[model samples]
Target: MQTIQTDVAIIGAGSAGLPAYRAAKAAGVSALLIEGGPHGTTCARVGCMPSKLLIAAAEAAHAAAHTAPFGVHVDGVIRIDGREVMQRVKSERDRLVGFVIDSVNSIPSGDKLSGYARFIDNGLLEVGGHTLVRARSIVIATGSSPVIPPQYRALGDRAIVNDDVFEWSDLPRKIAVVGAGVIGIELGQALAHLGVDVTVIGARGRVGPLTDPVIKAYAEQTFRKSFRFEARATVESVVREGDEVHIGFRNEAGALIHDTFDYVLVTAGRKPNFDRLALENTSLVLDDQGVPVYDPLTLQAGKHPVFIAGDANGVLPLLHEAADEGRAAGANAARFPHVTPLIRRAPISVLFSDPGIAMVGARHGDLKPGTFATGEVSFEDQGRSRVMLKNTGLMHVYVDRQSRQFLGAEWIGPDAEHIAHLLAWALQMKLTVDTMLEMPFYHPVVEEGLRTALRNAVAALQAAELQAA
Candidate 1:
């Protein structure tokens, strides 16, 4: 058995783990990154990068086909080569992975070992072939895995999850996407645009159910025009018969209707990957869902010299949130006096569906009875969205009616990701609603949509007061 020593041992090399490795090195701490698979985070590998590439290719093909309606006529048939699309997706994934490896190797500190990382006890990690690595502090950044329902496990390759969806050499002739969450809706729409007969099945009452109602409605409308969508359908089971995968759903009449597809893509949400890790051997406590429980401020797991970040902590599941938590964990692990951290600001979430969905701070449901005000603006008011034919989206702002401080912001529209950042920063800096109104934002741009949303919030707040009087 080989024995290794480090100041900090980081498990998982995804978004959170990689950043933690860098943070530890920057603080002059000896760190070791333990990854179960090849380098690169989910965003760089299967989750974000490949999915977005597939969407981009699909959108391009759709655009080319419709170019004739826009007065651009081409004599030839616009075709989609699924094999070629997968090749591009794989190439991009490989390039990004290579870049990450090169950067990590160049660091000249902290080594990466490819293997499953498990906790032998507090502050000790067992990795690849009986190699034991001990550190003064351990950071668990093990990400999450797709949640596969028991009924669909047998379908395996025929009915795949996001992890193996892009591995196909050719896209399916028809695909049934289960769970109309962000991934399912986006990929289903993209596949439909690429000429695949795609059907999106939402087990919930509506698509994008975790999102704001306004965003959810807009997404449903957009998806309706692109592919077949069924909401509030409960899936009983999935069966693979011959070359076709059949999904059974209970309709409103309580009768099961089976729909068959060449393939089935399941986006039923993801579960933490910590099950393989022997966390029971350590002092670390896990929640009922098998995720580590950590102090939201310090991200510490109990009194043990171990920290949790990323999906493992289950604090925030998004990639950016994982990276932020990782940065904080790594820096604190390397700190001398035993560190404690404060929540810097609220977390933000962004979805990459057509017209996108971005949210920062809290939602209306998260608020209690208080002197609060809500505001919204439509993308119809934005020149950029209007020109891009993306007028179906909306921007929402929440503020304290009395203090006028910015509370939160949510948008589902063009450039929502970029706009959310500014809103998040403003909220964190304690910028008031009046301050945002006075700020200068470029006209004829998508960014200006936020300003309009803020204005609406103010007006709506005043209107509510007038009604009360």
Candidate 2:
């Protein structure tokens, strides 16, 4: 058996782990990066990058097919080549992954370790079967994996996850997408636009991460026109047929629906990769979900010299959050007893469905009633959206009734992704509705829609104040 020692050891060389290793090294500590899987981060490999590539292709196809409203007409049918689309997605995805691989390759060979790491005890780790590692501090950034329910697992090759989609030689004829979360909605819509028979089945009334009822309802309505969507599905059974996956569920009309698809794409959500890390051997306390109890600011696991970051924390699964958490966790691990807390960025989430959905800061469910004011706008008559012929939109902005400060927003609109960032910045700066209203709004722009929502919030707040007085 080989023995290796380091000041800080980072398990999993994905997005979070890579940043952690870098931050520790930047802090002038001996850092070692260990990985049991491939080098490319989730974003590069099967996540944001590849998914966006597919969406881009879908957008192109959709635009070509729907240009008649803009007085533009295609001479013939716009054909989407499934094999070509998958080829480009995989090719560009590989390029992005290659960049990440280059970054990992830059690390000195001595500072890198190969193999899965398990905690032998606090401050001690056994990696693979050949090496024993001893470190003063450990950073767990083990990313996450797709959770396949046992019923779906029995479908074998007939059932696939989001990662499996990127590997397709060609798109399937028909696919049943389970879970209408971010991944499911984005991929389901994209696949539908690409001429695939896609059915999006979601439990509960969830549509992406939307909590605002109006926005959620508006989003659900908009997507139903594009694909078969069953929000709050009554599931019967998910079993395998001869060469296909059979899905049985009750539709919105309470009609029993039996369908067979080339694959059952389960987007049930991802489980953080800490379950196999032997966390029970450590002194850190585990939550009901078996995740380490850690400080959000410092990322310290209990009082031990261990830190948790990325999807392993199961707090925010976004790439940007993972990177930020990784840097914070690594620095804390490198500094050990002198760990410092970091002020995190305001929360932001966006789903890349046509007429995208965005959520920022506090959710509607998180806000207490009467404590906040809600403002809304619809893009059906918005100038730029009308010009672009993408008038399907609904937006809701919220502000603290007492403080008049911007609280958060949930919206579905044309270019909602861009709007969400603006709202996130406002939330972080703690800007008031009046102050936001004072900001510049160029005439005939999508951002003008945001200003209208902010104004509505101010009026609503005033009305509430008047009612109280």
Candidate 3:
């Protein structure tokens, strides 16, 4: 067997792994990066880029069809060509994927290895069948894989996941989407707008990762206008029937729902790819969920030289979070003998469903009721929303009642993603509610809605103080 040595060894070449490799290099550490699959990052290949491409196409189609309300009628019918749409999505997805692949390729050939890496022992990794790597410290960023339920496996090709959905040359006429989380909602709504009959099933009564009740309710209301939602639903079984797939589920009322569709797309959730890593060879002890115990701030796995980051940690699965974790883990691994604490960014998440849904910083449930006050503004009458004819949801901001500090925010409204980022930055800087209100909000813009919400929060706090006095 071939033997190699390095200061740091990074497993997986996805979003997190690449950043870790770069950071380790920047830290002047000798690093070896390994991957068993394609070099392109997950976000560029399957998760974010391709998904957004489909959403963009769907948005264009929806815009053209709905322009009649704006007194702008198309001279000809606006028809969706599934083949052309998929082609365009694939063409652009490949370009982005190629860019990531090129970046990975730019690494020195001697420092890059292509194979499945398994831990044979602490500080040692066996690659593929022939090579062994010994490193002082290692970073695990193997990423995650889609969770395919056992019941759906028997249905064969009819059961699709996000990894398979983007590759299809033609979309199914009807699809039953399991798990109305971020992936499910975004793809489901986009497919529905593109003329695919879609039914989204959520195990809970919520869609997306919405924790705020106000935003969840408004998001569900708006989403219902685009497609069918079977919340509090569970898939009992799935069977292939000739050309179609028949799915059996129990609805919220416990009523049996049997439907036949062209395909069943599973977006239930994702689990970290730890099985192949042979982590048992290390001193790390995995918890009940098979995730290694580690410090969230340092990303260290126990007191050992091993570190876990990105989706592999199973903490925050968003792309930006993964990137940040990768950088921290890489730097820490490079500086192995001495550890430095890193402050994580405030949590920010967004679901790209029309009238986008977003949450930033602390969730509503995370805040103490008496300590915090909420401010809200509905987009139903917002000036910008009315002008754009995209008014549909609401924004809720949470603030500390006594300190007037902005705690967090959740919004289901037009351009909530952009507004969420602004809130995230403010929270990161520890900005106060009063300070945010003082920020300029251009007239007839979505940001004005945020200003209104912050103002309302201030007013609510004043009311509470007056009652106490």
Per-prediction TM-score, please?
A: 0.92, 0.98, 0.98
* Candidate 2 structure, TM-score to reference: 0.98
**Of the pair 1 and 2, which is ahead by lDDT?**
2
Lowest-sum lDDT 10-residue window in model 2: 238-247
Model-by-model lDDT, in order? 0.79, 0.92, 0.90
* Per-residue accuracy of model 2 over 1-469 as CA lDDT, tens digit each: 8999999999999889998999999999999999998989999999999999999999999989998887888997788899999999999999999999999999999999999899999988999988999999999999999999898888999889999999999988999999999999999999999999999999888999999988999899999998999998877998787888878999777889999899999999999898679988988899898998988889898899999899888889999999999999999999989999977899999999998999999999999998999999999998999888889999999999889999999999999989898999999999999999888889889999999898888889889989999
lDDT of 3 by residue, 1-469 (tens): 9999999999998888989999999999899998988879889888999999999999998998898888988988778999999999999999999998888888999989989999999999999978999999999999999999888888888888999998999877999898889999999999999999999989878778888876787788788889989878877878898879988889889999899899989998999999888878877888998788998888998898988989998889988889988988899999997877767888899889898998998998788779988999998999989999998888899999878889898888899889988999999999999888778888779888898898899899999999989
Off by over 4 Å in 2: none
Task: Tell me the spans in candidate 3 whose CA falls farther than 4 Å from its real position.
Answer: none
Query: Which candidate achieves the best TM-score against the true structure?
Result: 2
Q: Model 1: per-residue lDDT, tens digit, 252-351?
A: 5678888889888888888778787888888767778766677888887777667788887666687777888888889888873477684655667777
Comparison by TM-score, 2 against 3, better one: 2
What order do candidates take by TM-score, descending?
2, 3, 1
